[model samples]
Target chain A: MSTVNLIYFSWVRERIGKGEETLELPADVVTIGDLLAHLKTLGAEYESALEHQNVIRAAINQEHVDHGDPIAGAREIALFPPMTGG
Target chain B: MTAPITVRVQRDDFDLAAEVAALTCGRADIGAIVSFSGLCRDEAGALNALELEHYPGMADAEISRICHEAVERFGLQAATAIHRFGRIEPGKNIVLVVTASPHRQAAFDGANFIMDFLKTAAPFWKKEHRADGSAGEWVSAKDADDAARDRWTLES
Candidate 1:
């Protein structure tokens, strides 16, 4: 098990009630999808924040990645909705 | 010479003329410049302002990546992108993209390419501030924007 920093943005952060947190990952949490699943078990806030798994976008070290991507040695991971900037 | 790409994410508003002048003031090779400014609209008077939220480091990095790609793909001489965060009122500028190229078409295409990609890839979000003193809502991401961005990938 290892610790990693996780960040939430926009409504994800609003519902999670915090912008970031440090969590100790279980050995089974090998991918981003697994992490999201694990987070949902922690509390209702996490459950609400990640209610829709498909639309939740993830970024490993600030670059976008698929949910199935491995989170082996990432220092930070940010999750948010689809971007709306121009 | 390689194209110069400038990507800035800040809270301050930028001047259109100054940015263009900085990139093309003394250049003889560049003959065309295209600048696009994205502004905040009042939503037919339902909104007072827009609050832009962004991931600090990633916002700048993602936009820079998009600008660089646009410059290379269109053979632009220079590309500059500036995105503002925090509360922006109606009619104020929120984002700017300027591209310079020897030919008019490249400059236009380069600016358009940067905007299309930035809208979907950049780590920024907008929230509406109501004028009637009610709660504001986070603006939903539009599927139309995703469709717009996808056209570029299909072309290349």
Candidate 2:
């Protein structure tokens, strides 16, 4: 199992009840979509946080990426809602 | 156009006049400068403040990238973007973008372009704090903001 550091922001952070965590990803979790799916299975908080998968934005290594992006070598992954910054 | 880009993400406020001056100091080639500042609003007296959350490493990096792109696209001499993260009260500053160029239009366009992209690209979010002590909600991202960013791709 590969380890991944996951970070959360905004409502996602609140719902998940933490700012960040380290997880052991099953081999089947190859992409961000897979990660989200696996996270939902972890608990109700994650499920509630990622209820709307479409609106959930992810960044690998601090760069914006899509759900289809691979997680092979990602040191960190951030999940959050659409940015409202200006 | 390859000048240094200044990007700051802090909890403290910034001085717009000082920022502008810092960019233009001893710059004989720059002819025009445009500055834009975004302030928090009370939303008809309902807001006590706005709690801003940001991705620590990514916020400044993303804005620097956006500023670099704006500098390249608009031929800007310099660009600086500052975004504050923390609880901000009504009439307090939230963001500042200043762009300098050889001409007025480039400076204006550069500043405009930075703000349009910054709103959608920066890794920051706002949560409202109501004055009446009610629980606040995260501010939803606006469709208009996405449209604003997309329009720039069409322009250039």
Candidate 3:
């Protein structure tokens, strides 16, 4: 088993009621898809924000990654909106 | 060899010209400058007032990454960005992006690119302040903003 740090920003945080958390995952969860599935089980707040994949953006260790990317070696996973920065 | 970027999160107004001078100082190759200022529109007609909030450390770090990518994508010499968090009144500036380059085209493209990416990629949440004095609901992210950002990936 490995522990991963997750961060939710903006409305995701508002909806999820948290900014960051650490999770312990089974070794079978080796990819972002696996992680998303695990997160979807956390309850209504997590389900609502993540139910629609289009609105959320993901970054592993501070660099953006696609949904199909592997998360096996990731230390930090952050999710937020598409982005609105200047 | 020094840091070529500046990023800030504040509630105060900024002087555009002064900031630009600081960015372009001692760099003779910088022949052009372009900047964009995002303001709170009282009558955007779509939403009332907007309350913007951001995660302190995370917001700054992500914004710096976006600015760095903008500099490379547009061949810019330098870039500066500032975003104001908290309750902002109508007609107030909310964000600013300034880019400098040897050519007008790079400067212009860099500024536009940064704004487009910011609107779609930044992590700020807006709570709409309605006209009735009672707060309106949160404004969902617009598809148009996402489309605007997509155009860039295809072009470059």
Candidate 4:
């Protein structure tokens, strides 16, 4: 299994209090849902910050993706908001 | 010509005239240069300024991409943007965009296009410093900002 880079931005960064981290996930675990579930165990902060699932947006390898997408063989996973850039 | 465009995120204040001169840099073929400066206003009866936070690397890259896209989509000559984060004084520049083109309309439209998209797309968090010496952070997204962004889509 390859290592996955997890990143949180904006409010997510504030809530997580860390910018980026690398983790090795179980082979069976894929998809953003699985990642969120795994992250929930990190602490109370993750649980509260991620309480509402829909508001959070995500991207795989810098391109935005929906929650249902699988993370198998993913290298970088970034969680952010509805992208407010111009 | 090799550089896609210039996009910068900084904490210190910027000099508008100097930056513009650098970009134009003896390019007399550039007929029009459009610029937009967003200021920290005292609109809400507040004494202090606003503090902004962003996703660092992502913010600049996204904004740069937007500028490049706008240039290609709208036929612009060149575009540049500078967004300042952290504590900004009232009446200081929050964001600035300059677009150059052979025609005035393209330059103007390109600058406006970038602002419209940036307001809604740039992943920046704003927290205002109040007169009471406290701070109030803006909630997730604003409807007006979304409306501005939607106009570009409608045009296409």
Q: Which numbered prediction scores highest in TM-score against the true structure?
A: 1
TM-score, chain A, candidate 2: 0.98
Candidate 1, A1-86: lDDT as tens digits: 99999999999999999999999999999999999999999999999999999999999999999999999999999999888776
Expressed as tens digits, the lDDT of each residue in A1-86 for candidate 4 is: 55899988766777888888998887766788788877878898888667777878877776567788999767888886554332
lDDT against true structure, model 1? 0.93
Enumerate clash totals for all models, in the order shown: 0, 0, 9, 6
Candidate 3: true interface contacts recovered: 0.52
Q: What is residue B135's positional error in candidate 4, in angstroms? A: 4.9
For model 2, residues B67-125, the per-residue Cα lDDT tens digits are 98998888889988999999999999999999888889999989999999899989999
Q: Which residue window of length 10 is worst by lDDT in model 1 chain B?
A: B22-31
Question: What is the CAPRI rating of model 2's predicted complex?
Answer: high
- Expressed as tens digits, the lDDT of each residue in A1-86 for candidate 2 is 99989999999999999999999999999999999999999999999999999999999999999999899999999999999987
State TM-scores per candidate. 0.99, 0.98, 0.83, 0.84
Rank order (by DockQ, best first): 2, 1, 3, 4
Model 3, residue pairs in steric clash = A82-B120, A82-B121, A83-B120, A83-B121, A83-B122, A84-B118, A84-B121, A84-B122, A85-B118
DockQ of each candidate's interface versus the true one?
0.89, 0.95, 0.46, 0.43
Fill in the DockQ of model 4. 0.43
Docking class of 1: high
lDDT of 3 at A62: 74
